[model samples]
Target: MTMKPYRSMLFVPGHKGAWADKGVNSGTDALILDLEDSVPPVEKVAARDVVAETIDRLTGQGVRPDLWVRVNPEETGLMNGDLEAVVRPGLAGLFLAKIYNETDVVRLDAVLSHIERLRGLDDGHVKLLACFETAEAMGSCEKIVAASGRMVSALGATGPNADAGRSLGIEFTLEGLETLYMRSRVNLALRQIGLIHPMAGVWQDLANLDGLRTFCEDSRRLGYRGLVAIHPSHVAVANEVYGPDPEEVATARRLIAVYNEAEAAGSSAVDFEGQHIDIAHVKTAQALVDLAEAIEAGS
Candidate 1:
């Protein structure tokens, strides 16, 4: 699978033009222009117009970070209009919300396929971020991912969803564990299909800095590429959680250097910091370096 570093996925309201620009400029790996929850009921149409205009402005200005739009769920009044306004050039993918099953994914695939054709783009240029928020979606996450045409870019789920075990009075410790399991399943499915890493979910609180950090760290350990950010303040935490730390980068460089030296001597592994470094360790170290560089370059 082609790796796209989405260490930070910051959500910007579609109606807020200035904030949209700020979000892109924020040190996030990706900016998700949200047309769903961040937007209100009455302002949906205006939000679409604002998002389209912002996209046009960004494209004209040659902004480079991966851009995506979180469309309202299928069957919502704004879903079709969201697609119409958000499917312009330079769009990296779509953040499909409230995906209930594979059928919904298939329908969206067809819709995106049609939209691509109408716009004279490649039939499958636009990818999807399947948001598995419902119990049905959680149960069928693997199948939903498998059925996503062109492969979905990522998978996400929320903590307060009606389907979460937390809804049954389970403590967050257990709930977080469940979330980890669900995210792991989704990640495994995406990997099996050879797709990019999946996102976890939005932490929902902007002021609870500790909560955000713990949640992001949890997601990172669960194998999620990143956590979704509802507030720009959370972007830094998300990026830090997903990207390699300075110490980690330094260690990786050292391991890589030692491994190369050993390979030059016809050895398969090298001892570094009292630990044996093999090809897998070297590859992982290089990946960490790549992720760090991508974050610095904002691409």
Candidate 2:
């Protein structure tokens, strides 16, 4: 799989057009112009127009960050119109929220394909990322990933943050442990369908750098490729968190060089820096080296 590091997916409120510029300058790999949770209800229409205008201006100004637009949920009357305004060539992808099933994802793909065809652009060229919230959606994670096909690549799941806090009569803090489990389930489900590495979720509290760092490390350990951040200040941390350490890279290179020499000598296993090495060792070393290269390439 081609790795894409969604280390920092910063959210910019749709109404704050100025923040669009500020968001790009913040060095986030991607910015989400949120028409969902970030915008007030009454300002939806105005915000929609503002987001479209801001996107065009950003493109004109050569901002060129990964521009992802988070549309309101399908139940919201604004989804269709919001998408119509924002899904241009300048947009890198769509951050679809409240996706409850495979059908939701398929419908989104169809819509984007239709838009692209109407514009005389190639069909299925747009990228889509779906958010899983409900317990039902969590249960159907494999189906959702399968239904996405080539158009859908990333899957994000929020437990208490989106579902439990709003639905299951649970407190946010009380649901943290469950949220981690929920996230792990989704991550495993995605891997089953070959999307082994994908962006995790928004942690919400941008100022909690310590907590953020801890969570970032946790995500890395949990097989997550990267994470989503809601603030610009968190970008550098995200970028740094999901990569092979310099020491690890050096060790990987050493392992590979020694292993190669041993293999040329017809040895089944080799000793490297007083440590025994075998096929498994070489495989692990190669993976680390690849990760280091990906990080350097800003993947």
The candidate that achieves the highest lDDT relative to the unseen native structure:
1
lDDT of 1 by residue, 172-278 (tens): 45247646666788888887887757787677666988888888787777777787778878888887778788998999999999999999999988789999779
**Weakest ten-residue segment in model 1 by summed lDDT:** 162-171
Candidate 2 segments exceeding 4 Å error: 1-3, 61-64, 151-162, 168-176
Per-candidate TM-score against the hidden true structure: 0.89, 0.88
Candidate 2, residue 230: Cα displacement in angstroms equals: 1.4
Q: Which stretches of candidate 1 lie over 4 Å from their true place?
A: 1-3, 161-175
The C-alpha RMSD of each candidate to the native structure, in angstroms, is 2.6, 2.6
- lDDT (tens digit, per residue) of candidate 2 on 1-299: 33355667788999999998778887777788999887889898889889888878887877646788899988887788887888776777788777788888888778878888776667655677767766667677778877866434454444344663564444555235646766687777777776756776667775888877887887777777777778888888887887678998899998999889889999979889999889899999898897677656653
